[model samples]
Target: MRQSRFEQAFLAYLCTMDVLITVVSWLASYFISSLAWSLDFYPQQGETPPFWWCLRTVPAVILVSLLSYRLSGLYQLGRRWPLWQEVFHVLKATGLMLLLLVATTFFARNPYESRLASVIFLALTSVGLVLGRRCWGIYFRLRRRWGLVDSKALIVGTGRLAKNLDVALRSNNWMAMEPMGFIDDGVHSSVGRATQTVGGIEDLPKLVEEHGINCVFVALPLSRYAATKKILRLLRDTLVEVRLIPDVPALTPLAVQIGELEGLPTLNLRSSPYSFLDGLLKRTVDVVFASLGLVVISPLMGLIALIVKLSDGGPIFYGQERMGLDGRKFLMLKFRSMRVNAETESGPVWASQGDQRRTRFGAFLRETSLDELPQLFNVLRGDMSLVGPRPERPYFINNFRESIPKYMLRHSVKAGITGWAQVNGWRGNTSLRKRIQYDLYYITNWSIWFDFRILFMTVRAMWDKHAY
Candidate 1:
């Protein structure tokens, strides 16, 4: 699709801000260094290089900074990207720019080079760029919310796809799209009274002209290929942008990604959440936090173990087989919170709010979630993650997969000690369907920041009533 004039202008504005921020960051770094020790970070040295000499690097700084941003693909990133992703790109670009600046100084044989000042500039520019992006995001959101910058959109079909798109457009204002109405056959009325059908496809041009529509979204099903072609042919003379949203009901759960294979367009149906970099990042987080967690809580764990042992002279810890990524079963460790033979008669029953299996202190351990502390070892051992869907025993997994269609999809990632579902109060036999829904939501939108959010919520919800 062609870029709108507004989009082109916004991009130019951002580029201008990036250049200006870099220049200002350099000046600020020099000013900050002036108040401190001398600005001599090289063998050549004199007391803080002449203030006039600082201006010499402005051209190099601006060029390198903009080049770094473009090279990091920040220029192509859309506003739909999450805030964390945008911030990370900015940081990555800034780091690259600083590296380039240092290399240039070494090769240019400059008489004045201050590594300390460069570090300061790096710190300042990172914060400045992030804050600038945040301010722009706020402005963009407010403008869209107030209808100051928006595109009038018209749906070309009235079906399940069209209805879903309408709901999505209304709920997610970040897209900055305003729905004018639907243009389809008058047979369907499920789109609601607010967005009434203007007319059939023949009347699309008239409706567009009347409503000043600038965007057309086609959601016609595969079976209506002829009708879709006719609609596209009719839209040829119009100046509006046309986007085709494929109506593939069978692959609704999987997000569609456009790619190329052997010079032809290809669509991927199933993809793992952990790309190579994502795996490395998550594993690093798990190993670091899990190792630290075990070290910090070792004394408390020992106390819990003693209490469990004193309660009934049984095993201090219990290991049970639970399924993890790709349906791999592993021994999951936990501080035993129930009597030795608690499940001997029942075979495999879920813990309820209250039962006769507790030994007084065991109930407290379960309620306070102290019993799950041993899972930190599993995280460090690479069998689990700090945040993911909670694993279940093979016995229950067998039953759940039979009843729930998307139950097995959660195994695509390693299980967690505390998860999105558990933190959201969907645990302990509340509603299996709702728990699966939250689990799927987490898996679909997995990110480091999202995991942190779940962990924070877990701490706040520790005293929840459903923990039993």
Candidate 2:
């Protein structure tokens, strides 16, 4: 669809701002480098480039930056585009532009006026570009919230899916999508649902014309094959964007991927997180974090070990079999927080609040979650991840899998020392069903930043009520 005058004006403003920001960033980067190191501190005996001489490259840098952002799709960002993704693309474009600037200088047989200044410019501009785009996005979001222009949306079929989608769009005001109403023969009265019923599928085209619907969503059930086909055929003449909501509301899909299998479209429902590059990135982060954590906390861990060993002259470390990724069992290590035979007779019983089996120091360790420090080694050994679903014992897994739905799905990813469930107070004999829900949510929404947030929350929740 052709963009409106407002959208075109917005895009033009963004382009103009991009050029201005690039110029400012180039100068700012050079100024920062000057403050950090003397411009006369050159690697070779070439004349120190004066400010004007260095400024000559700013125009070229700005041109290349604009081209890079255009190629990176930064200019095509919409209101719905994720801020993180936009920032990432902006940073990538800035890096490319910097590389281009360096290459151009090298090709010209006159290396950068000042190598240090060039490096500083790249670092400064990369950060500035991302911040600039973020500010732009924030301004638009605020404007949209204050009754700016919004896309008119029409939802076909007034089923549960349609109602849910309506509620979601209406609740998230930042979405900037105004759902007009539903168009289904089943729903005649709209006393409680999303507004009044506009009309059935028969009146869809007229409604679109009269209501100025720019976006149409077909949310009818999959069972109504005839109705769905007829609706699509009717809407074919309209120039609106039509989207079909797949009728699979019962299944909870984690990391869904759409691909072609033998020339046929296939929707993967149960996609795992450890696929190719994602797996590599996750493992690489895990190893780096685990190595650093073990080094920094070694002294504290040693002290805990000493205390546990002296409490009863028993083993300092306890290793227990627990289920992990792909249902594989691994010996999870932790500081001993119980008597020698605390669970020998009872056999795999969950420790409760104020459990008498715990030693005095052990109780403190359990309360503070210091007992789980040894699992950092497990992360290093690749038996677990720094963040994932908390591993459960085989004894309880056997029971939960039989009783609870999707209980074993938590094992789809590597178990972790602390998980979304634990930080959210679902640890140590809490509701198993709720734990499974949070574990699955974490798996589906896994990202480096998400992992960092969970880690921060874990540290903040050190004295949590459910730690025991």
Candidate 3:
């Protein structure tokens, strides 16, 4: 496969921008510092110190600017453009860079360094750098459209998405992408009249040779992982760039992303929403909190145990196998809220209002959600988090997976003792669809603040009307 001249040029521009932004951002730092001094933001009289002092502020500004760009993805040129997303980003990056400079000055008390000068440098430099790059982007994009830079693309796998992608690629002419045709996989083959399936997946070499294909996009289904893998492996010998469009089941429940390992694409089927340092911190919180909870509630747990034993001579503790991250099964602990072996007859039935298995003492525990308290042990065991989407029974998960798209996406993160579903009062015989919807929201927008909010809500929802 041939390499597109346009892509080469665009990459060159990106590299140039990375260097240009660094240099210009650093230089502007000095001028900004002087300006801050003039504005009385700096100390009026500071000792004229060694020139090495200036280097401190300059390096800090440059590092922060690079971080801002990297995190904001300022260099991913192909991201949706033509809207004010670029302008919005520019404003944000520039503002953050300036704020960072202020913090550094406040932290470092140096006699020679002018805190005022640093702020001025950061503000002016950031504004100039971001705005300048944006203007260049607009111009470069417009110029690339005129066949000045273009990529002849061959998309493998035909369907509405490919058709739409083809139209978008063609219409955004400045992107320099030209769709040659759609190569339908062995499945559906309504590739349209203008398009033809040059050859089967095996004949990709000949197709690439004949069409002079510059790019090969594997827009196949994720369910066809084997086929997608084969197509990728076969294309390795070709020079053409390869891109994949994830299948619908893998695509939905948006905001999730595929991770890579040593250049091989991988489904991040499991992730501890908190990783490395944060994970260590969250676990510390869980262990310390759960241990205290056990100590504080031991007497009450004992009282509940006696009542359950007296009522039906049932097992004091309930141990139900539930699905955890990556579909691993773990025994989730709870106070007994039903007959000793409730699932002995029919398996995995939902606990309905006035469930037949709910003995006299069991009903009280269920109503107060004391039945779920022992799951604090699940948290201590590391099978669950103090806060997250509630882990469902394997039986229900299997049932839901068949009907839901990306249903297991929630399992990517740790299962929770109490979750968005419980907080929303959607647990236990409530709408499964609504519960899953909340579960998805929690998965997508997860953050420390979100976890805290869910924890707060769980407390409030304990007495909630819907909590039976």
Per-candidate TM-score against the hidden true structure: 0.82, 0.79, 0.55
| RMSD per model, one decimal | 4.2, 4.7, 8.0
Give the alpha carbon lDDT tens digit for every residue of 1-468 in model 3. Answer: 223567567656764665466556555555555555568666557644444666555566566767776665565644555435565666666667656656776687644455555455555655665566666656746765544545677777776566666666655544666677777656544465455555567777777878778888877666555777788878888898787766653456635345778988676534445547656777787788789989999898888878878887768887889998888999999888877677889777887777887778778877888888888888888999888778888877877999976688788778898888888788877887888888888876676656777888878787655544
Model 3 lDDT-worst window of ten: 110-119
Task: Order the numbered candidates by TM-score, best leading.
Answer: 1, 2, 3
Task: Count backbone overlaps in model 3.
Answer: 5
Which of the numbered candidates is closest to the native, going by highest lDDT? 1
The CA-based lDDT of model 3 is what?
0.70
Off by over 4 Å in 1: 1-9, 35-46, 51-53, 70-73, 76-96, 103-116, 119-153, 159-180, 187-196, 205-214, 221-226, 236-240, 247-250, 254-256
Residue 145 alpha-carbon offset, candidate 1, angstroms: 9.3
Candidate 2: how many backbone clashes?
0
State which candidate has the highest TM-score. Answer: 1
lDDT of each residue in 119-208, candidate 2, tens digit only: 676667667767776676577567656766467888887777888777766654434567888888766778224466778888888888
Superposed Cα deviation of residue 372, candidate 3 (Å): 5.6
Give the Å shift of residue 271 in candidate 3: 7.8
lDDT of each: 0.82, 0.78, 0.70
